[model samples]
Every structure is written in structure tokens, then in C-alpha cells.
Target: MAVAYVYGAESRDISAPYSIWKVVGSLLFIIAFIPLTLWLVKKFQLAQMKLSQSEIKVVSVQSLGTKEKLMLVEVEGERMLLGVTSQSINHLKSFSSNARTFATMMDEASSPETPSSTEEKKL
Candidate 1:
């Protein structure tokens, strides 16, 4: 809008035509927005994932990079990968266009934790 306004003012034309470069620029802008929007969307999804669940049974915890940890959990027969850190948790998973159930059995197997008892331990 700002750029369009500037062009309109310079040309003294209320209907400043949209050129190919302008279209290309718009296309490039939209293309650039793809990754950024995806990042934001992922951030929101992770936030919602973290907040929606009552609890996440730590399926498997492993080192991500150095200080980060990865977690897996099961719910309604679906698997989710969670990124744990000192500050917050981030959910990382393959992008799905529509609603789908991801079969992540291997991930579950590789990341299983030793099941412990809920009852008091007889230590």
C-alpha cells in the first residue's frame, strides 16, 4: 500500500497501473512470507500443543543439539515430537496440509522410556 501510494503520488495518477516488476515484487514478497509464515504457524502449533494437553508422558528424551532435548508422546493413536529446553517446549513434526494421523511407530520405539509405577516405590 505504501509503495503503491508513493507511485500514485509521483505519477499523479489515481489509478497507478501495476507493472510486471511490481507483480514480481509482490510474488517475491509472498514467496518470502511462505517460510516466515510457516515458522510463525509452527510456533503457534507448538504453543497450542504444549498448552492443549493436560500432561505429556515423556516417551523418550534425547539431546537435540547441545542443550535441547527431544520428547515423544502418544494420544488418540498419534505420535508427536516435542522439543524441550530450559525455557520452553517446541513441537517439531512434518508439515501436513490437512488433518491426518501420522504413523510414527519407529519414533516411538526408538524413544521409549522405562515405564515407572504411579504408586509409591518401595525403596
Candidate 2:
């Protein structure tokens, strides 16, 4: 009688329903989750990139040592030469954006002086 009872219990457990829908749903959820996570990561990365965009532009850089550098940057129509290191950034010089170029100065120097201007200078 005890053997029959044990056999009956085992048969009841084996006869339990196996739902195919549950297995299919879990697989679909797993498949959909990967792309969703990747999309969210990409969206946040784009937002961070947009936030970092600014008017300040780096025109040039020269490495001085292992950790020291010289950087030329332009911001708000002013150009700045800076010394940069791990500890601090120092301003070396600044240039006005509206300043004339060397080429223009050379052209002015090479041009012939008008007679009226020369006469005015003598007077």
C-alpha cells in the first residue's frame, strides 16, 4: 500500500501542465530587452555629447613634457595662449580678434607713399 501511494504521488507530479505560452513569452521578453537597453544607452550618450558642445575652440596644442602642454584657444572672439599642466592652467598671452594680420602690415609697408602724404609729413 505504501509503495502504491509513493507511485501515485510521483505520477501526479509528472502529470502537471507545461505551458508553452509562458516559455514563449519569456523568450520574447529577453529578445526585446537587449535592443531596448542599447537604445537607451545610445540616447543618453547623444545627449551628453550635445551638452559638451560649446563656443570655445582649441586652435593648437604642443606637448612640453610628459604632463605639461601649451594650448592655444579661442573663445568669444579672443585668442589665448595657455600653459597647461596637471596642477594648473596659466595664461601666457592674449590676442585681440580684430588685430590686423602680418600680411596686411607688409602690404602697407611695401606700397608707394602718395605725394600728398609725403608733402604733408614734410610740412
Candidate 3:
């Protein structure tokens, strides 16, 4: 009979201390994870920003892809680009020309040399 009970014992009480500990542990895990989850969400939402500094100044914003959540922002004179991965921001060729037409810019205000051919005296 003892051997039979050992093999086919009634289910243990789920309301026991071990069960209570499991519930508490699960709750603690959820609570602890909340802030980290929120932080990652916030990080996901931060837009990549770039500024151009020229007569045709521009600013642009782009969303990082799920696989490309890490962005590289580059500013060269009045040109800026955002890339999944690149040697320079120059890779960012998509600019809101509507915005660029109005906000001549860059982060460091570097003025690239104007094309010498375009400097002819006005008639």
C-alpha cells in the first residue's frame, strides 16, 4: 500500500507555500520587466535627426527599421543622411526638400566651397 501511494499519490495542494512562492516570483518578474520594456520602447521611438548648414539648409527625420534600429547620422556641409550602416551620413540622400528650401543649416555650420563656375557676375 505504501508503495502504491508513492506511485499514485493524490496531487499536492496547489495553495501550499511553494505555489505561493511561484505566484510571487512570477509577479516580481513581471514588475521588474516593465521598466526595461518601457525603456526599450522609448529608445525605439527616438527619431534620427540631422541638420544642414547652407543657403539651402535642411533638417530631416527618419525611422530606424526593426533590424536597423541603430542609425548613423552624418552631416557634410549642407547635406545630411541617415543610414542603417554607412561610412558617412552622406548615405542619407532622402531629404524633405520642402523643409530644406526654408531652413538653410548643419550642426557645425561648416560652409562648403561654392562652385566657382556659378560665381559669374550678374548681367
Better-scoring candidate (TM-score), 2 or 3: 2
Residues 1-50 of candidate 3: C-alpha lDDT, one tens digit per residue: 99877655444543466788999999999998999999887766653222
lDDT of each: 0.69, 0.86, 0.53
lDDT of 1: 0.69
Clashes of each: 0, 0, 7
- lDDT of each residue in 47-74, candidate 2, tens digit only: 9877996789787899999999999888
Q: Rank the candidates by TM-score, best first.
A: 2, 1, 3
Look at candidate 1 and tell me the lDDT of residue 66. 77
Better of 2 and 3 by lDDT: 2
Candidate 2: count the clashes.
Answer: 0
Candidate 1 vs 2: which has more TM-score? 2
* Cα distance off (Å), candidate 1, residue 63: 14
